[model samples]
Target: MVPIFVIAGIAIGMAAFVLLIQMAVRNGIRMSGLIDWRTQYELERIDDADGGKPTLHELYEIAAKTDSAPDAIERNVRAKALDYIESRNSIHVRNCWIVIGVAVGVCFLAMIITLASSPM
Candidate 1:
């Protein structure tokens, strides 16, 4: 029979791993500034005095400040911001899932190895 302590250890390890993943996602998004830009604001348009590529923060600032919510420029900025955040989040989720899949596969393989090697 499988040991109760082994089962408990696996359960605790999985729970801890899930909690770590959750905390990583929360901290990663916040650290990347995606969390800050998630808002409905009435700021002001950011002038590109240098006429160069504005940062995402600047675009967000200009995007939310417009009086007309759906104007071409504002809509474009909004779309860009949404796409940026979504893409970043997608990447993080993909990575986490891949790691989980790999870990599960390794554990499964280890179990098979042990079961096959054991005497009948």
Candidate 2:
């Protein structure tokens, strides 16, 4: 039983570590402003061309209604940005929860192992 708990704890810890790394990389990309460049460029382009400010999603909707080649390209870029933001945010939330859960599991396992081996 003790060995099993030890193994489980190790596995959970490794998983938490991987999640931490992924979160770090995701945040790094976001914080470094790499993800915003394309979105910003697109918004600026739309602002210059139309002079009517629209949110990214709004721009995507507008582009969808248009038949112009430029609008098609804009729609694709906006879609990609929206998708990236959504996915990255979900990953961040999931990583936080998993890491917290793993920490709690490790603590519980430690307590159980200690109680099992200690003199009662």
Candidate 3:
């Protein structure tokens, strides 16, 4: 149905807006440089202190071997994991926003043409 298509279009537009906002957040993090520095510094320290560089999965094994509190290890690991997750999310958000923007633009044009022809 036409109405259904219009609704879908609007939904796509809203999706785009949310995605764009997410993209902005990701860019902000990159610009702030905290994620990069923290991730790198922590990884380097982890490598140096733990005998060698550990892949992310290996961090768990290293933590298990240490006498230190598991909580601290888990916390640091979670932080690193989140950085990776966010990096991926940023890309998805950017793509969604672009698709949504195109949908909304097309919908708007359709609405304008429909409205102009109506004899109200």
lDDT winner: 2
Candidate 2 lDDT over residue span 1-120, tens digit each? 666777777777777777777777855665466757466444344534455455666656666666468757676756666664555556666767778777777868776786787677
Q: Stretches of candidate 3 above 4 Å error?
A: 37-104, 113-119
Better of 1 and 3 by TM-score: 1
Candidate models: Cα lDDT each: 0.56, 0.65, 0.61
Using lDDT as the measure, what is the rank order of every candidate, best first?
A: 2, 3, 1
Give the lDDT of residue 103 in candidate 1.
57
lDDT of predicted model 2 = 0.65
- State how far residue 16 of model 3 sits from its true place (Å): 0.8
Model 1 misplaced stretches (Cα beyond 4 Å): 1-20, 23-54, 57-74
> In angstroms, how far off is 87's CA in candidate 2?
3.8
Show model 2 residue runs off by greater than 4 Å: 1-11, 36-65, 69-76
Question: Cα RMSD for candidate 3?
Answer: 10.1
**Roughly what TM-score does model 1 have, to 2 decimal places?**
0.47
List the candidate numbers ranked by TM-score, top first.
2, 1, 3
lDDT of 1 by residue, 12-100 (tens): 55775786588476647544654445341111112213334456667757866764565776677867756655655565566677667
Better of 2 and 3 by TM-score: 2
